[model samples]
Target: MKKKWVHIIIISVVFLYLFLPLAATFLYSIAKEWHNTILPVSYTFSAYENLYTDPRFLQAVGRTLLISGITLVLSVVTMATATFVVFMYLPKMERVLQALVMIPFAVPGVVAAVGLIKVYSSGPIILSGTIWILIGAYYVLVLPYMYQGIRNNLRTIDAKRLMEAAEVLGASKIKGFAFVIMPNMVTGILLSALLSFSILIGEFVLANFLIGGYYETIQVYLMRRLNENGHLASSIVITYFLTVAAISWMMLRLGRRFGKTEEIKEKIS
Candidate 1:
């Protein structure tokens, strides 16, 4: 009983440590006149009201979503195909691929951004200060997540044996990969996509340096608002948190549904 209570206390401390800042931010967003008190003198929804009514906020959100969605699709397609080929045929190239992806992790974001700007600012095809550049950078940014997630999922499903079975059933390599391998990878793909999207949404250094106000994303907008109003900035943070949470929840539900459907199909087969 003592050990149980000790464990409960430790967990509670950890939870509070993680949650208190978010709770304070939420409180600040709603507080009308909080001054040296344990609680607010009063509360109002004006911060959220103003945020929702702001056209710039909506535009910023739209831009962020657009870029993130496009990047997610591009990363998923490219990484999935590359990982599949490496595992299925070019197994010897796996180490090379791993080293390539790890480059993003080794380099600092600021360094990467500066290098990208320097390289692309005067290239045969300049991508500086454009969404294309951001998309390209984001594609590289997500390579580690996409590659590892899909690779792990492929290993989990014993993709080699599955492909052999598909071959016995008279399916070509392409068809086997498409119909047999890809479906099993749905959960990992969704998870990696969600993680990449969340990171892209919150990322500031690359976006701020690469595009700046030319293409103001939600993070940039939030930074601009932070200097203007504390309440509004707090509201934005809360909203950002909620948006990520909602997306994560939706993706988890979709993954679960996909798993169940796959199970049913397996039982039938």
Candidate 2:
């Protein structure tokens, strides 16, 4: 009874913590005088009504999705290939390279942001404020997460045996990799993409410094509106929440796919 009560309390607190701001955002989005009050003097849908007609919010959504899609593809392919190389062929150098891959994680996001700014200050390819720079910085910030996730998935499979069997069965190296090895690693690749997608949407450190207000992601856009005391900002917050929830749903689906694969088997004639 005590343990059950503790669990209930913990869950309740977590729900409150997670949902209170969302609740407040909703309340303020429809409120007239939410300023300096325990409750609103009145409620209205005027905030959301105004937000739908705004172009900046719509543009922020488009830019956020555009950058996230690019980052997702790059991160998934890069990390999945790295996992295949390290686990299948370069076992000797895996530890050293793994350590190197984590250097970005050790460096603060602010430092990376600053370095990227100076590095791109002037070049044949000036990327400081471009969407590409944000994508690249996002890749660096979250590469470790991808590496760890895909590497774990590779560890779970009999990568060496599977690759060798496929190779010996008239499967050329590339085809074997593409069809045989890749099918097994699909879950890992999806998970890595999901993580990269999540980080890209909300990662403000690099977006704020490297790109600044010139091209803002949702977080930066909402933050800019936050200072102005407008109800449109509340709608932005809810959009951000829904975006995160979608990524979470994708990650859970990946987990279920991997888990179910173990229980199902194939027959050999």
Best by lDDT: 1
At residue 115, give the lDDT of candidate 2: 86
RMSD of each: 2.8, 3.1
Report the error of model 2 at residue 43, Å. Answer: 4.4
Worst window of 10 by summed lDDT in candidate 2? 260-269
Clashes found in each candidate (C-alpha, N, C closer than 3 A): 0, 1
Q: What lDDT tens digits, residue by residue, belong to model 1 across residues 1-269? A: 99999999999999999999999999999999999999999999999999989999999999999999999998898899999999999999999999999988999999999999999999598999999999899889989988998887787677888899999999999999999999888887898898788789989999999999999998899999988889998998899999989888977886776567556656755
Tens-digit lDDT track for model 2 on 1-269?
Answer: 99999999999999999889889888877888766888899988877766666788778878888887888778787777877788888899788868977888788989888888888879787887788888888777777888887877766666677789998898987898888888888887778778777877778877888777888677677788876655777776776787799889988988888666544422221
Backbone clashes, candidate 2? 1
**lDDT values of the candidates?**
0.90, 0.79
Q: Which stretches of candidate 2 lie over 4 Å from their true place?
A: 32-43, 123-125, 262-269
Give all TM-scores, in the order shown. 0.91, 0.86
Worst 10 residues of 1 by lDDT: 260-269
